[model samples]
Target: MKLSSLRFFKEIVFAACLAVLAVGESPAKVLTPDFVDLAEKLKPTVVNISTTKTLTPQFRMRRQPSPFPDPFQDFFEHFFEEMPRRPQRERSLGSGFIISKQGFIITNNHVIAGADEIKVRLSDGREFKAEVKGSDEKLDLALIKIDAKENLPVAELGDSAQIKVGEWVMAIGNPFGLAQTVTAGIVSATGRVIGSGPYDDFIQTDASINPGNSGGPLFNAEGKVIGINTAIVAGGQGIGFAIPVNMAKDVLPQLEEKGKVTRGWLGVTMQPMSPELAKSFGLEGEKGALITDVVKDGPAANAGLRSGDIILEFDGKKINEMSELPRLVAAEPIGKAVKIKVLREGKPREFTVSVGRLAESGDENNQKTAGDAFGLSARELTKDLAARLGLKESRGVVVTGVKQGSIAELGGFQSGDIILEIGDKAVATVMDYEKLIKEYGKGDVVRFLLRRGDSNYYLALRIE
Candidate 1:
């Protein structure tokens, strides 16, 4: 090789090395976010929340007799009975971030639920009494307000829909009562449904979120709040979950205006579309929610949606999974007519249905009773019937009749058996039983807790 060619080759390699170094430096700066400055700016927006709940103790009758003699026993019994049982106060700590200069804050509903008094403490050593403006138990979110009487430092809300996994994030909360604690880690995952609730779109992160971190702010690299730290896996390290800020933002207006969330209801019970079920439906792949049942006269039913229909899209959004449909349906405005694309018997169809408001409590009148499906007739347990059944309390539904050779009879259900619970949820009324029973579909094995002759026993019945 010539000397001039060798020198030119060496110079080219050196220039390429310099170009690589320049490209790497920019991403290194982007990846290693300045947490110290971010923490200082966000600390004022985050606040410590302390709640006090008054719990009244229930007195249970003593079952065993005193070990002492009659006179000593009588004296001890009277003395203990006369003693006053005072109401107990429980104190809990959580974290919240100011969203508005008018003192509005966002936190998890579990934090301030049943709290008789709530106190908010700012990082500047100021304290104020807070009140719950609105709460949604289904979403586990609460909007609270404090009368600071001045403009407060508010956190910048970011679009969580743009958040991707492996992005650097920071959490600011009062974990374990440690106020203004900051933790940083990358987003572990997104759209995680850990069975938290119907809308279980949580942003999973490795940020250290502890007991008292509920309702804190999860920030992006730009110091904008993207999530609300809400839950953590028990005994698991670097596993935490946060509510997406976009969801919170959607609920905030309703919470601030109505003091409760009124979600749009589709009045349909659905299950995940499995590959086998998809094949049975003549679908190439499992990409839609399979409707198990539709409430009679419901918005869906009125729109001609049937039990066998497969929901492919709702309001223009593609329904890729069963879990996505509920969140999408709930977000729609009530009374607004929206297009629903469904596959019925392997044929495409569309329907325009007006969304209905979901009742906060399950409305039994609107729900389909479980009698026809289960082949059992049940009546609400009245006080008179409770006495007849030798029950101390009038609760649950008493089985009035059972069909011959039906699933109920096969499951050992008798006429006098009281249905206490269905599928692990307590059935205090016939409505509760009906609403819960409708959640299961064909081929699903459902467990029922029955109180038969002063004893409780669970019965497993497969729906055929």
Candidate 2:
């Protein structure tokens, strides 16, 4: 109970308390000063977009009588009679950023897709009626213009190509109709393909992007717009996708001048170069798209490109995967001759191809018939069959039927599949396939190149 002892106990208690507090608190991340300032400056440029769409309902008519007695039957029929549903008006909310002081804004195509009226509200409580100037559904991008007399704050679009993973980013949007909601996170990855579209090079981030965040601006550290918030993985947390600003910049001129997107076509069907395929071809690395079938008389065909060639580069840009090829070719100007490098028989070759406008129906096809040696029945592909199969050229023989429990069926051969090649030799007719089959004796395994729908793969079938 002495004064000296009491003071020592109090000091000990204070030291224990400090130790507990230190363990509970972790080191905080030091944010750059620009983050807060950039977000505040960019807020005015981001706007909330509301769209209204009127949809009409379609009703089906019933002519069959009701199963009931006379008077009751008439009442039942009346009750069951198909009544036309009234038209309904749907309202949706999204977000966008002004690209120009003249009231030009950029957003997602789906935001104003079928809207009859679009209203844009700014942070300053000002509202304006907007009209869609252009949109590209493939890229899911839209450009709209509003007649605003007031000078609007514009957000600068930055180079997304220069952005690196783990860099800080911010997303500003009207998530769930909550206007001007801001979320911050780091770039988790780049060039992500979620299979949402053909050109699906998305910037994946951990930003808290939810419903209604689509069409918003994803800002870089400099407060510049680097991406357009587009999608999020369903039922996933901390996963969101944005369209890179570079892609938007490349297609902006086409959208502004043509009101739609036009892409250059090489007229070739391709698949990713798998490790097995790469090893078979004696390649050191797998980094290109394997050409499955080439469209006859198409740009690639005219340029001397053939099936089984692996496209290494397009227009001097290295193609790392099969998906990258489509985006690269699409971005090229139509009719422009571009240099393409391909690996054929393990040797690299370069060619200059005059790019052609991509046709909506561009797909490759081939045909031939086996002589019952493999228990498979097939016939040469005709123009009609090719068209029905959505094929560009009639080159392969279509499998008519595969005998059950037979070698062909056991080898995964199916009806409606076109056989393009037999052991590196192209099969263009029934005789070609029959001659190839005759060359194979009993118990001999041969690799067959087959086309099913738009995809191509090689299968090995052993002759019985």
Candidate 3:
């Protein structure tokens, strides 16, 4: 009797221990949604915006009389007052979302660029006129406010920087003016540069975003706002770009505080050093922006940045590529002193730079040009390069061949024309031209200078 009871008790104890172990050692959980409750709760804040602007059209003078006598017609013309303005309403559509319980909205700048009237429609079909809070053309971001009361639904914010490729994402917007269209896809890429802005670090997604989706929210699967839908490649599908919310966090506060953004500037035109340039510079790694021009009285110039200096880091952020420096410098707090690392003459040099506020207008840098003639190409002449090119003064590049559609003819370059330097640089040679074409590449300008038969000319060329 004692052995049977003891065995039964032992078996029961073993079974209980196994049950506890099973509960504690379960497999890792899946990242899928446990419920769609969060998404359902946040959908109400999404909005559609319709804007209209009134334009006065120009009218031509009447060719023939209105069946009136000559004296009468002349009197009517002379006696009549100025013609009344004819109002023509032009309409545009875009998307927006409520960021505040009190009805603050966010969208792209282009959405309301010339809008005279803005109407925001909520998910409940309620429409309200929105007033502009702030807008920035540099980053294409806008914040608008609408009057509303009571507690409202707000989408949660997620760390877009923490998201990775292949993670699921969703977008809700008025694509092509169609209200509340939902698209789903994975994060195709991160930190995409589509020539959008100086601080363009876009999240590439397959989610379909049309013209009207400019200000829509790119939501994570958690129903949180991670990015702002901003652009779509025209004539392309499954290609869309969103501004990462993480990058917006700092700018958002400034936008809300002063209705504008104040960024730091080093006053330099920089370019990524190619493999050839890197070898010539004796750089061990292809890292850092090659300073081409340092603005007079700019932070960089004050900090001792010089042409051919390769900036390697700022504030301890390892700058592996040249593209990272512009936004990094601009994002810094103005008037703050920062440390900059550079590679000069095959050695590392560090400098302390007092950061300066970025001027909204005017050229950021200036470099003397060297106009010269090489084997096949002629370039801008500066004291430095002119010494190399046997020239005495600064001028533009000279073209010997007007190749068909090969940067020359397409640029309207004549056989003997000189090409003055365009953006970032004053006058340019093939090297400067290549550096410039590869640098400050956020725009469509590919300007040049031309000298034809002893006459100087300036030409606007498109960088294809």
Using lDDT as the measure, the top candidate is 1
- lDDT string for model 1 (123-200, tens) is 998999999999998888999999998999999999999999999999999998998899999999999876555698
lDDT of 3: 0.73
Which tens-of-lDDT digit does each residue in 1-464 have in candidate 2?
Answer: 69999999999999999987886685232444366787789999999999999976433222222234365655654654556568789999999999999998999998999899999999988899999888987789999989998778999999999989988899999999998999999999998866455687889999899989999999988888999998876666898999999999998887778777788888886766778999998777889988877777989999999998999989889988888999989878889999999899989899999998874312343222244667788765655345434556676678866764577776678777888999999988765777688688878898889877677888887776
| lDDT of model 2 at position 314 | 93
TM-scores for every candidate against the unseen true structure: 0.75, 0.67, 0.69
Candidate number that wins on lDDT, 1 or 2: 1
TM-score rank order: 1, 3, 2
Using lDDT, rank the candidates from best to worst: 1, 2, 3
* Candidate-wise lDDT, in order: 0.86, 0.82, 0.73
Q: After superposition, how far is residue 451 of candidate 3 from its true place, in Å?
A: 19
TM-score of 1: 0.75
Which candidate, 1 or 2, has the higher TM-score?
Answer: 1
Error of 3 at 418 (Å): 18
Point out where model 3 deviates above 4 Å: 1-39, 56-87, 361-464
RMSD of 1: 11.2
lDDT tens digits by residue: candidate 3, 336-428: 899999999989999999888775523353222222111124433433233323333445554433433344443455554555656536644
Error of model 3, residue 154, in angstroms: 0.7
